[model samples]
Target: MSENNTRVIVITSGKGGVGKTTTTANIGVALANMGEKVALIDADIGLRNLDLALGLENRIVYDIVDVVEGRAKLRQAMIKHKQSQNLALLPAAQTRDKSAVNPAQMRQLIEEIRAEGYTYIIIDCPAGIEQGFRNATAGATEAIVVTNPEMSSVRDADRIIGLLEAQDLRNPYLIVNRLRPKMVKSQDMLAVEDVQEVLGSNVKLLGIIPEDEVIITSTNKGEPASATEGSLAGQAYRNIARRLRGEEVPFLDLEERSGFFTRLKGLFGNKK
Candidate 1:
């Protein structure tokens, strides 16, 4: 369709447990908090969990399926976030499978959301490059591929990036989630440079999110970490949102926090 003021971004990961849903929720929350009208779509359908991640599971009366089937209007299906008035969610149906909606329908639904004047529409794509992936990416003007700092995750991300490029989608940015600086420092895990080397030079690095307890606690509490201050993972997500808004922001110093404590200990002659 025609390009407009709104930008539809599909957050995808070829492999599961790479934090695509979490990234979508936090980025939406961050953008909304910045006064941008943002819409988050759960495109996982029967396996939908974006609502739970954003603490809006109980608030979903209607979903994207309802709107697609003409059972509910777009406005009626969107659930506004309690954390930010500018952020809303268009949840997926819990009972319906991925095949329940097709690519064209997804494109139309996203177009409708964009027409409603949202500055950003982020779609949480299901894991793997299948029907769900196709449906989730139908209307995407941009793509954010989330991956962990490992061989399998990076391999899958490269595959997904190839798919997006084949479909002529915009250059997909990479978000390396769950990176542990200690492991990398100990040479027990793949470093960020290694991941970039394997993924190729054309791929753009968006942001890196460190492994943090706040993410787990926030997930359990059904609250997005982005709305919680002093959360390292949340701050990393907010940085990604700012970068997406075309602002110059540095990639997070994943080792800074730990190193700071080490330096303080040495200053007091308590080095271990």
Candidate 2:
């Protein structure tokens, strides 16, 4: 391996609809924005969506399956992101099933990519405990567990964390997504503190992404929200990027409507 080989990291969510793919896409861009060479692999197989999230769906001539099957070289399968010169994507084969590739093959492919001099290689794992998930996490040096602040999401995250530990993939971090502080205050949602208590383990908080309509619009438009500076979700992903780079960043206060003291402090500061 070269001195600048890639570091493989997996972004996984134990349950569906927890913004795993979205996180993967944005983090790839965020890392690249920091001048680190980053690559994203969509290990979702038949349900591939990372390409669409990165807006590289139409440019994929080869996929991960083709590279493993000797039909295409790894470079041929990698599609560079349009906006980020340092970011790239290795899409999943829409024509292939999860069984077409195995964990060992996935590891081999990642190793090859690592030798090619990328700094960060992120794999977007398929949802659920199946062969696809195994293939996705085959060679993860580190992992990011994405979960919403809810019981079902937390339960699924626990299952995934258990599986990772069983496989000796320790110290995976957590990113609390779509957190609504007002809802949590009203007893309608789970707060980050509550989530940490239930998981029964210490996980470094990355960033908190709020439920934003702009995120949905960006996804529908096939553009990552991280591309926009005005987006709260985009800011959250950027903070995660900084955290990934070992920088200390403060978490965002998601709840609106400040306390009387806080409001008074803001008012006084404005007057000064």
TM-score of each: 0.93, 0.92
* Candidate number achieving the greatest TM-score relative to the actual structure: 1
In model 1, which runs have C-alpha deviations exceeding 4 angstroms? 1-3, 259-272
Residues 165-192 of candidate 2 have per-residue lDDT tens digits of 7767787889999887678889888888
Error of 1 at 210 (Å): 0.2
In candidate 1, residue 77 scores what lDDT?
93
Task: Please write out the lDDT profile of model 1 over residues 92-134, one tens digit for every residue.
Answer: 9999999988999988888788888898999999998999999
Best by lDDT: 1
Q: Enumerate clash totals for all models, in the order shown.
A: 0, 0
Show pairs that collide, candidate 2: none
